[model samples]
Target: MNHLKLVFIILCSISLVTSCASERSDDDGIEPLNTSESYEELNISYGNDDEQVFDLYLPANRTADTKTIILVHGGGWTSGDKTDMTDFKNFIKDQMPSYAVVNINYRLADENNSPYPMQINDITSVINYLKNNEAHYTISNNLGLVGVSAGAHLSLLWSYGFDTENQVRMVCSIVGPTNFTDPAYLNNTNAVLQELLDTFGIDTATDFLEEVSPYHKATATSPPTILFYGGEDPLIPITQGTTMRDKLESLNVTHQFTLYPNEGHGWTGLNLLDTTLELKIFIETYL
Candidate 1:
């Protein structure tokens, strides 16, 4: 499977799914708004760093009660920009117009700077900035996180462990790594996977690994989560999703897990459609 082609197909499917899903209304007490006055602010800096900026999209007729969805992209925590999530941001803006969208860019990790607490801190800063300026943005503190790969790992880690105020109502992970300490990772011989793990310092103490692993950080009170994975993914093994699912179940946390058996690190076509619909429903139910 050509990776680029697969990504294109995924994006196309998302656009189609968003178009189809937008026509349906739910009796879940939330009504879709019809307006043409949405707001968008790009390169809003939450910190001094160059990468500490995010793009905000405020829906038309939004209020302080309006919820938020934050998008985090994936590039092994060392690369990737906010633009990588443009498709998702647009999908949310069009399909879930009542909700606000934030696509963020965090400092990429390098040999001199590790990804752990730093990238995690960036997420915290983004949330703090949002809450501090809630009245200005006219959005609620309630949040839904949607991340892919490394971004997904960060979303799970923060929502499960670092969310002190319980602001995150729901989170969705697409091909995200959940457990750094999972044997699938620790024992895998894949150089690319190992290189990515090295950014977190593979030689570190076991406790530290557990500290960063969402599988270990999740508790009964953790927010509802939905996860998607591919059975044949070269970077993230099947255990990454299944283990987290099992952990969520053991803790009695509300969660959903979907696995595409023949796909790789990412997927497209009907599976992507299913993922988008499932994610949309989960957000409606929990966020």
Candidate 2:
């Protein structure tokens, strides 16, 4: 499978989903913040690294009580940018106008810079920056994460393992890899998949794999989560979603899972619509 094609499909599908949802009216019963004006701050740096910047969208009438949604894009951890999630930012702005949105870019993984602690630390820094500036941004410390593919994995990992303050109220993972140690991954022969996993390290230890896996890090107190997966996805196997769903259920965590059996990597049309609708409901309920 062509990795570029996969990335293209993921981006296009997300755009299509959000675009389709734009035609629908918002009736989620979420009270809109009473701010008189909305604001957009672009390239707000949270750190010295150029990729450490994020774009923040503040809805009109937002206050210290306003909720926030942070979006993380996906390119198998090595590539992708905050701009890739533009449609998602727009979707949240239009649908959940009361909530603030942050679309962020983190240093991508490469031969020297591994994603493990580096990417996770970036997420931690982003959250810390948000919390530190909550008063200035006029938003609450409460956060909801919406991430796709690699971003989804990072979102889950950070929320489950790194968020000690319980700041994340909800998280949504779209076709993210949850378990690196799963048999489906360990026994897989996909070259692209192997290349992506190799970014973690060569001769990686089992303990390290489990340490990085969201499935292994999640606990009973993990925040409410909504998961979406494509059963036919070439990179992520169906078990990645099902096993995580089972684990969440066993932990008695608040969660929902949806599997599109016929889809692969990404989807469009009715499935995409369904995803957006379900996501909207999840955000309304949990965020």
Superposition TM-score, candidate 1 onto the true structure: 0.84
Q: How close to the true structure is residue 149 of candidate 2, measured as C-alpha lDDT? A: 86
Q: lDDT by residue for model 2 over 1-287, one digit each (tens)?
A: 32222332333333212211111112333344336788777888877777888888898877778899999898777778888788778778888889999999998766677666888999998888877666566789999999988889899999999999999999999988898788765664556544444434443468867887899999999999999999788778898899999999999999999999999877888998799889999999988
Per-prediction TM-score, please? Answer: 0.84, 0.86
Please provide, for model 1 over 1-287, each residue's C-alpha lDDT reduced to its tens digit, 9 standing for 90 to 100: 12211221222222111101111112334433333468777888877788888888888888779999999988777777888788788777778889999999999776567677899999999998888677666689999999988888899999999999999999999988777677665554544434334434333467866887888899999999999988888777799899999999998999999999998777768888788889989998999
Residue 124, model 2, lDDT: 91
Question: Relative to the unseen true structure, what is the C-alpha lDDT of residue 136 in candidate 1, on a scale of 0 to 100?
Answer: 60
Model 1 spans > 4 angstroms off: 1-36, 190-203
Per-model C-alpha lDDT, please?
0.78, 0.80
Task: Specify the poorest-scoring 10-residue window by lDDT in model 1.
Answer: 15-24
